[model samples]
Target: MLIHHHKTLCVCDFTTLLELSQPKISRHLAQLREHGIVSDSRKGRWVYYSLNNQLPDWCQRVINETYQASQTELAELLNKSLTSESCCE
Candidate 1:
């Protein structure tokens, strides 16, 4: 749910999801990417990741529903994905 919310998302965003450290969030992303659950693309120094919508429809449904749940969480989710975390690391 968290991973896909920030489509074209990246590491710094995940950190805040679990209230985790950057390295920790990164590790999680690494794991997900390794499993083909997520994907990445380099934009200069930043790497953006998003759910591979090519996955089964069920998977996409779950992520989309989660993102649609609350406005605040959605805002935070996009912020983390587009920019780095707005606060301290």
Candidate 2:
């Protein structure tokens, strides 16, 4: 999920990237939101999530490092978002 650093992602994006069920994704996202690691905004019927910039510097640094380390996988996951199909309405 750290791959979402500095970017907004819809639940569909996470579902596609993780190949997980919506309920599972929502559960995890709820946990992240609870911990102040991620935040969400409504765009129509969809909600997009991004890393919470207000997080501690150390937390941001860790997310950045993890994102950097997973660049290849992240790129592949991002490519999926370019498709016309997604879990969103």
Candidate 3:
């Protein structure tokens, strides 16, 4: 959901947006990275993650469909995130 909303995100962003622990967010991101569903790059002390642009067309389609199906809920979450104090900032 975060990826669908933001171009890129850090561990702090996930923790703040999802209200999850840093370790839990890191673990999930690591799995996505390992599966080639997401990619990461490090800058100084922070690691940023984004959806892999090279994902197969079918995979991208599935993601798009899923997002569309959950658009309302995801949008509400995004709005909440936007209103909250951003960890990235």
Please give the CA lDDT of all the candidate structures.
Answer: 0.66, 0.77, 0.85
The residue-by-residue lDDT of candidate 3 on 6-83, one tens digit each, is 879899887766888999999999999999999999887789999999999999999889988998888777765643
In angstroms, give how far residue 3 of model 3 lies from its true place: 0.5
For model 2, name the residue pairs that clash: none
Give the residue spans of candidate 1 off by over 4 A: 16-18, 66-89
Q: Give residue 84's error in model 2 in angstroms.
A: 3.3
| Candidate 1 per-residue lDDT over residues 1-89, each given as its tens digit | 66554355556555555567988777877888898788888766777788776778887776677767766766765564434334422
Error of 3 at 33 (Å): 0.4
Off by over 4 Å in 3: 82-89
TM-score of each: 0.61, 0.80, 0.87
**True lDDT of residue 6, candidate 1:** 38
Greater-TM-score candidate between 1 and 2: 2
- State which candidate, 1 or 3, has the greater TM-score: 3
Query: Per lDDT, what order, best first?
Result: 3, 2, 1
Query: Top model by TM-score, which number?
Result: 3
